[model samples]
Target chain A: MPYRPFDGQNCSIAGALAIIGERWSLLVMREVLLGRRRFQEIKRNTGIASNILADRLQTLVDHGVLERRRYSDQPEAYEYVPTRRGLDVNPVLIALMQWGDRHLAANGPPRVPVHTVCGHDAEPRLVCSHCSQPIKAEELRVRPGPGANEAQRAEPLLPAD
Target chain B: MPYRPFDGQNCSIAGALAIIGERWSLLVMREVLLGRRRFQEIKRNTGIASNILADRLQTLVDHGVLERRRYSDQPEAYEYVPTRRGLDVNPVLIALMQWGDRHLAANGPPRVPVHTVCGHDAEPRLVCSHCSQPIKAEELRVRPGPGANEAQRAEPLLPAD
Candidate 1:
């Protein structure tokens, strides 16, 4: 498939999607984040074709999300490790997992996130940084910021309440 | 392209992706979330082909993420509105936006989320529900839950520290 870029949108979500929006990219990230870094281990977990996985991993490395490091000298084996940027994808994964757990999971969540700091199952919540209050979709709106173009700066993006 | 289902993964993230993992799906959700529900408006903003947009919207409606309603009588204009399931996608979008803002945005964030409740610019942060402390990717681990399959139950998914 030809690469279709979202560069014209001038929106950050679009920007991020342009990088990680492929169907298998996040699943590959999931494997690495779960500590399955070797080529075979990620392949075993995701059932993704080896060629596709190699392409995705190369893209991730090019994007600075994952760093490839030699792990074995004799076999010339390497492990893919998450850089800071890759680790930052945790929230996105957790948000998706929670959404699935609520609407799709029939039995229960297959995996639970445990916060090592609090020593309990982590139900991650999105909160406002300024007020430290939980944010709800209805209670949020968007305003043009420093990067806004003329059309965006002219009006708030969301509907008036 | 044939529909690829992630059902065999037994993972909630994969389940969620199976629904919205299409390249254009989340961008469509972004349009509706930002109050651009009209077909022309969405097409203008996202540069998505009309047929593709129609298909993505229908898929979202079929999945109960969006509710399509007639908004005009003479021309038979319709609009897409977010259902509870769709509204729940806000977190994923926000997480993606923040990631893009931090990594891709050269100037700054094009759109800034504002918390209507606190009347402040909302920098959304993911925090543990129990401890209410911010979550860093390194400080979290995953364990098998009630929905875990036999393989998942056999061991922890993430590496041990």
Candidate 2:
């Protein structure tokens, strides 16, 4: 019954949605994140139409999520690479995978993430930035910040910290 | 020129494409992430069609990214909350914002994130699980485990930790 495109008013999440929240956009990102930098490789994997893929690539390039680099001068070939802005999208893709694996998998995780550094399988644990303590939803509090709206008077949205 | 979605062939990202990689879904997630729990608020904020909002919410609930909770018994009022699975999707949303704030914003970040534990602004930093060192794309090494398909070769996707 709801449309949840973004959370807070005028927040980064909202701003992001305004640009790349369309269908096929993140699919393109998934390919770049997965190392499919070449146009042909990404096209082969996703099965997206050529025209649509071209548009999505241009959009991502426009959004700074991908950069188009000339791969071959003979054919004027190009490959799309994630910039810092693009590479940062990995966590989001990982988070989405965690959701899909949990709810959608027929077997177990259709895919698994290996924390290359952990020396073992790794699960991301959210920790408090200041205290360095592991944080959970109940353990955290939310309050109106500099961006709070005039109508948002409901007990700071979360319990006081 | 290429239809990149099918080429890289990592299932988690692929599965993410089957669900949320479509248009309007992430923006919907944005609203949910921002704390709008009702159908009306989501639709209002996102300007999505009532039918489309209904469909997206159903898809999310069906996928377990969000759960429908009864707010009242009489009318069977419900609100959506992230299961542990749903909250896990935050990183993707964050990544999208990082892209948006950097490329889309004319000024600076339209919104900011705060580390609830320390009571100040904090950004999510990816760290190497092995050394607990903050990780950048260049520092990590990943080899596919049992999950690697024919599509995923030894080639590292994105920059390694």
Candidate 3:
């Protein structure tokens, strides 16, 4: 099937998904962010096939999320490094890790993120940027913003609670 | 191609991806969480073809992330609802939305999540649950936990900074 695009949606989640929503995309990012920059290393870590890995890496590079830099001239070797936009995907991966640990891990998390500055296990939680208060899943609602389409704007806004 | 499984990885993110990693899966969840529960509603809102939507919904239901309940008997209609496991995916979606808004959306966010308790836009940020301090992506590192396999445990640990 040809790639499905979420064009004209005006939704940020959709926009983000357009770039990194493929099944192997975020996993590739995880490998790179974990310091497996070489193709063989990323492939070994992710278990993605060579062709698919090549395609995803190209897509990430095309979208400006990753940059491929030459590491060896004679061997023509390259390493994939995260660009600023690529680094921005860290929160998304962290959130997924937390959810997976809480809901799916039977033996406990396979890995845990640690806050280097504080030298403590970083159990990341979402807090409201405006009030700096913790935000729970059920304690939030949504409203149309500047980019909402006509139909979305007409939909009734309701409190999640 | 047949569905690819991330088996024997022993990673929570990989575990979660094995369940909800398909391109349309999370978008389907977004529709349901936004209160579009009925089949026609979710279909119209997401623009997902019937077969693919059916597959994604069934996958979610099988994984215990969503529950299908009868809402009508005469026509034998059903509605998909988020279970506790499903609701836990909110943080993942929220993190993606924040990333999209910051980096993808050009006209501003199409919708903004509001903290019902504070009655203001949530603008969620990640903070360390241990130290209760905001966490930067660069200021974190990962170490093997209780579930790590021998290979993963053998990998070198490096500070994210």
Which prediction has the highest TM-score against the true structure? Answer: 1
Give the winner by lDDT: 1
Q: Residues A106-127, candidate 2, lDDT per residue (tens digit)?
A: 5555445556555555555445
Each model's lDDT: 0.87, 0.63, 0.83
Candidate ranking under lDDT, highest first, comes to 1, 3, 2
- DockQ of each two-chain model: 0.76, 0.33, 0.72
The reply for model 2, stretches above 4 Å from the true place, is A1-9, A101-125, A137-155, A159-161, B1-10, B73-76, B102-122, B137-142, B153-161
lDDT of 3 by residue, B1-161 (tens): 13656878888888888887676888887887787888888888778889988888998999898999998999999999999888888788887888888888778888889887888887888899898989887776788888877987897576242
Looking at model 3, residue B22 earns an lDDT score of: 70
**Model 1, range A32-108, lDDT digits (tens) per residue?**
88899999999988988899899999999999999999989998899999998888888888888888998899999
True contacts kept of each: 0.87, 0.32, 0.78
Give the candidate number with the greatest DockQ.
1
Fill in the DockQ of model 2.
0.33
Q: Deviation in angstroms for B62 in model 1?
A: 0.9
Which tens-of-lDDT digit does each residue in B1-161 have in candidate 1? 23574769899999999887777999998888888999999999899889989999999999999999999999999999999899888888988898899989999889999888999998988799899899886788889999999999997766642
Clashes of 1: 0
Q: Give the better candidate number (1 or 3) by DockQ.
A: 1
Comparison by lDDT, 1 against 3, better one: 1
Q: Which ten residues in a row have the lowest lDDT in candidate 3 chain A?
A: A1-10
* Error of model 2, residue B95, in angstroms: 3.5
